[model samples]
Target: MKSMKYFLLVLLTLMGAHYVEARPVTLVTLGNSLTAGDGDDGIGGGYPTRLVSKLQTANPGSVLLQFGISGDTTTDLINKQLTPAVAALNAAPSANRKIALVWIGSNDFFGFYNYTITEAWCSGMGLEACENSEFGASADNASTILAALQATGAALYIALLDDQSKRPVITEPALRAATFPNISDEYAARMATHLSAYNSRVQAHADTYGAQTVDFFNTTIFEAPATLSDDGNHPSGAGYDAITDIWHNAVTGSSPSSSSIVPNSH
Candidate 1:
């Protein structure tokens, strides 16, 4: 069967007087603020840019298209970015290799718990019930997106949620005690557990689709003061650089850099 396919290709080449050429790999990203590069200096100012810098050094003509939005949820990715990401993959030749990134779910949790979300919903659903529902929905959407892209024969690199309880948005111990004193560290701990479950969902989806899962659960940049920007939620330049290293290690299957050591996606 292999020989037959090669013979047909040769015959077609002779008839058309044309030669087959390889296409550079395309990297399409779909996620939230991290993928959109929200907390970075500007649009295209996040890890993707650093990733491009790394990829370009080897694959000069490689294409990088990021479809991240600052506050996108898993549903937002499905409703908004999924179609475009598939379109981008389809535009390339069938034989070309492709890579995509799907790092989301933080906002699903954040959106549910934000001050503007109102307590009525939580009181009705119960806090644990709400968390479980979000977790299930996030996993389902991630699976749908991964299956569609996998059908195009592209390699995918899905990321797990970072430990957001450490982010400034949730940390300020004193302020947290004053603001939501009833549930300060307790809330953070609950979020950490939920995110871990979400990461497991992402990993299961990746395994089902022959994709790679990138890790961010144990990264210290978010926990440390140096890597965070003034907003505290968004990563500083140094933080992005550290994230780039993490991504580089993930995509290339290398050991983590000096910035981090959390390796296994599982």
Candidate 2:
């Protein structure tokens, strides 16, 4: 009977371990106003909340935490958002899945544009040089955030910023230059080019860190009035659902694009 008693104790220990392993995952979203569900229906809980619900259907007990501060840039993410997310992810039980979804840089571009044009800040750097510098800094800051997220061993997905040029705020001449006063079409086009380059850098980072990319830059919801809010920037409730559908596809391994998941560079 001594042998039987020992076996029971071992089985009980194993069962306890299994119970811990069966706990829910945590999905952390790092983004800006849109990710916060700024313009969505009801009380402004948008895609992230819907995404949490969707994930719960598959990962029953899974929970979500959104750190999407409006006007947050890549620098803000590095200086403010990264530390807490990394800590939470690392502190969670090792068996639980730690996942992160990052989408930022909206204010970074605006900030860069304004800073570059300011006579005092620009001095004699020349507009092209100033823009390039801002672009590079944004990319570098984003890389830093991604590295921190990767360090926590979380499954990472970094979204490429959408084409602001398509947004109503940018297209309408009066509203377009609201942030970057007197911004010309030609100059805005250059900004879009810089944004594209930024996205390329984002994909490169994902390749380095075994993460994924969601190509909102190439996504079609921009001009679709139904997908965008009345203001033409943040997504509507239906837009959130559409965004979540795309995210769900990526999470389920059927990535929207063939190159969505970056291959790790050993």
Candidate 3:
């Protein structure tokens, strides 16, 4: 009877261990308006919320903790969001898998084009030099955010920023005239080049730290009218849905480039 009782205790212990190991994961997203679901016309908070639902379907009981502030730049993320995110990840159950997703830098570009130029923040520095300095800062800030998240032992996914220069706010003449009459063709061209370099730096950071990159470069969501919000900047409900699929695919080891996931309204 003593031996049988001991055997039963061991069996229950193993079952408990198995249950702990199989607990659903925790997802923490850190970013700007895009991650905050600014233009989402739907009740779903944003891609993070949509993603949590998808995650729960596969691994029920999954949780989402999002830190997305509108108009936040890479620097703002480091200053405001990173600490809270790290704390949350550290507080998560050790047995549950933890993941952090970072998507930012749109406002960095916007600030450069809109405020920097208008205010002449780099008046004497020359446009090329000013761009290099600004973009370099953005890259470094992003690297810092990624590195800190990695330290929490959570799987990290960093988003490659879309080229903001191509968004409807810039490409559409009417929108440009209404919103940013000061942004000339030359400035727009320079922005495209700098944004590309910034994305390359982000990719390098992900590679160095073994974090996966969620590609936002080749998507039509920004260019497509249907996918863009009424503001012509942030993603709409359908666009957020599309973004959710991309992140989901990246997490699941599937090709995120599937046409069904990234829709082209063109």
Q: Which candidate leads the pack in TM-score? A: 3
Deviation in Å, model 1, residue 203 alpha carbon: 1.4
lDDT (10s digit) by residue, model 1, range 1-266:
99986885687567653323323557788888876676676334799878866765544566788888888988899889989989998887554457777788877876665541357776688778877876788787888989888876676788877888777767886644544445446667887888888888788888988888878887787777788776667787788888888787766454443211111222
Write model 2 residue lDDT over 1-266, tens digit each, in one string.
99985675577467542212223567888878877787787435777787767666555777887887887888877777788888878787755677888988877776665565766666578878877787788877777888888888888888888877677767776666564565678767877888899888888887888778887887867667888777766788878878887776665454433322212212
Judge candidate 3 at residue 261 and give its lDDT: 17
Q: What ranges in model 3 sit over 4 Å off?
A: 1-22, 255-266
lDDT of 2 at 34: 71
TM-score of each: 0.79, 0.82, 0.86
Alpha-carbon deviation at 61 in model 2, angstroms: 0.7
lDDT of each: 0.72, 0.73, 0.81
Which residue runs of candidate 1 sit more than 4 Å off their true CA positions?
1-23, 42-44, 115-121, 173-184, 255-266
Evaluated at residue 249, the lDDT of candidate 1 is: 74
lDDT of 2 at 89: 84
Provide the RMSD of all predictions against the true structure, rounded to 1 decimal. Answer: 8.7, 8.1, 8.2
- Which is superior by lDDT, 2 or 3? 3
